[model samples]
Target: MRDLTKGGKDRTIFIGKSLMTFLKGHFERYQEIKKQLGHEFNPNDLIFFNSRGDYLKLRELHRAYKNAIKRAGLKNARFHDLRHSHASILLKKNVHPKVVSEQLGHAKSSITLEIYSHVAPSLQEDAAHAFDEE
Candidate 1:
């Protein structure tokens, strides 16, 4: 619901079924926690919050990400890399550039292409083969 984009523009993006299921389970857990807290629970609290039910600060989020990366044996990775990874995976799978751009909330498909041109060579080969078949 919130715009976390660099341009601060609000946009809608589709989530996969697996992610939707994960979110449903997360919401159920949150509701249970809220019920346990009763009067202490703030209905308007963010889904991601600190132990005290306050919105997580940027540093706190970064610290948690760092800890997770360390635990997962990842090196030289930042939180923003997750976005790059997602887009890269989608592009490599041959999803349309327009769709990828829209999902990434980029103002233009060119931006997506410019950022991810490295993934385009294989897609170009695929396109040439498709044309050959036709």
Candidate 2:
């Protein structure tokens, strides 16, 4: 409902086909639940919501995230760490930093590079090896 932080524009995050397939199934289940409850389906309804079809409060979201982390046997990770992890994975896989920056809604690609500079040394080595291969 609000503009994106860096660009003050609507941001779009493209999902993979697998995720789209899973979301399609999830939406069908939601529709079935609404039908059984005799509730009119509102397309504008939040995709993830409480049993009452209300958006979750911040505390509720945090609690659910904590529970998920515990179930996954992960420690010392905040929800925001997922963002950092995603960017780190993409950068390590040789995705352009500028593209990752835009995906992350960073004000500048430099910000993305600065934050993920730990991945740069391996990238530099990879580039050097590529030239040797050629």
Candidate 3:
């Protein structure tokens, strides 16, 4: 869940099945390691855990973000850029601004337009043909 505004707006993002499966597998492997340490398994444990079965910290989250981008060879990208990437892809697909705004949990559709609604070259070509006479 995410708080979209100071008080007025609210939105929640439901994770997809693929992400849930990946997290579930990670949790099970983490529990196996904990069992080797003679610790009890807690099914309600967090998504990321430390060696002592403690919840992971924000620093660790940042490290993983940075590491994954580096490993992916996205040398010029930042972790925050992935959200922009998602929005850009959606916009290029001709998805409506209102729908994209909700997915992004933005309080204003104008913000989505301001950021991502500009026509990229490929999408511009698609738009040109969309209304072409048969």
Candidate 4:
């Protein structure tokens, strides 16, 4: 809803089909719960909300994230790590950096490449193999 952190512009972050399906089911359940409470669901309302139907405060969200991480037996990981992981996975899968940058709402593709430069060696190897095949 708000402008991106770095770019200060609104952009769409496309989701994969599985995520889309999951979101659709979640929305349906939300609507049903609202109906049970004798309230109409607002499509524009935040997808995730606290029990009182408000956006979660940053600290509350962070606390929940930390608990989940601990329960999963992960250490030294923050919610932001998921974003970096997503970008790294895409780069390693040979997705174009420009596309990943757009998805990440980076000011430029170079920023994505700069941050995930460690993925470059694998990409270079893939390129070499592709060239050999050709």
Query: Would you list the C-alpha lDDT of every candidate in the order shown?
Result: 0.87, 0.87, 0.75, 0.86
Error of 1 at 62 (Å): 0.9
**Number of the top TM-score candidate:** 2
Q: On residues 8-127, what C-alpha lDDT tens digit does candidate 4 reach at each position?
A: 766877889999999999989888777775553443477987666667889889989999999999886979999999999999999999999999888789989999999999999999
Each candidate structure's TM-score, on Cα atoms with residue i matched to residue i, is: 0.84, 0.87, 0.72, 0.85
Better of 3 and 4 by TM-score: 4
What C-alpha lDDT does candidate 2 achieve relative to the native structure? Answer: 0.87
Q: How high is the lDDT of residue 13 in model 1?
A: 80
Residue 103 deviation, candidate 1, in Å? Answer: 1.3
TM-score sort, best first:
2, 4, 1, 3
Off by over 4 Å in 1: 1-9, 132-134
Worst lDDT 10-window in candidate 4: 37-46
Top-down lDDT ranking: 1, 2, 4, 3
For 11-119, candidate 2 gives per-residue lDDT tens digits of 7788889999999999999888888866554435779887667778889899999999999998968999999999999998999998999899887999999999999
Among all windows of 10 consecutive residues in model 1, the one with the lowest summed lDDT is 39-48
Weakest lDDT window of 10 consecutive positions for candidate 3: 37-46
Q: Global CA lDDT of candidate 3, please?
A: 0.75
True-vs-predicted CA distance for residue 52, candidate 2, Å: 1.5
| RMSD in Å for model 1 | 2.4
- Model 4, runs deviating above 4 Å: 1-5, 40-44
Q: How close is candidate 3 to the true structure, as a TM-score?
A: 0.72
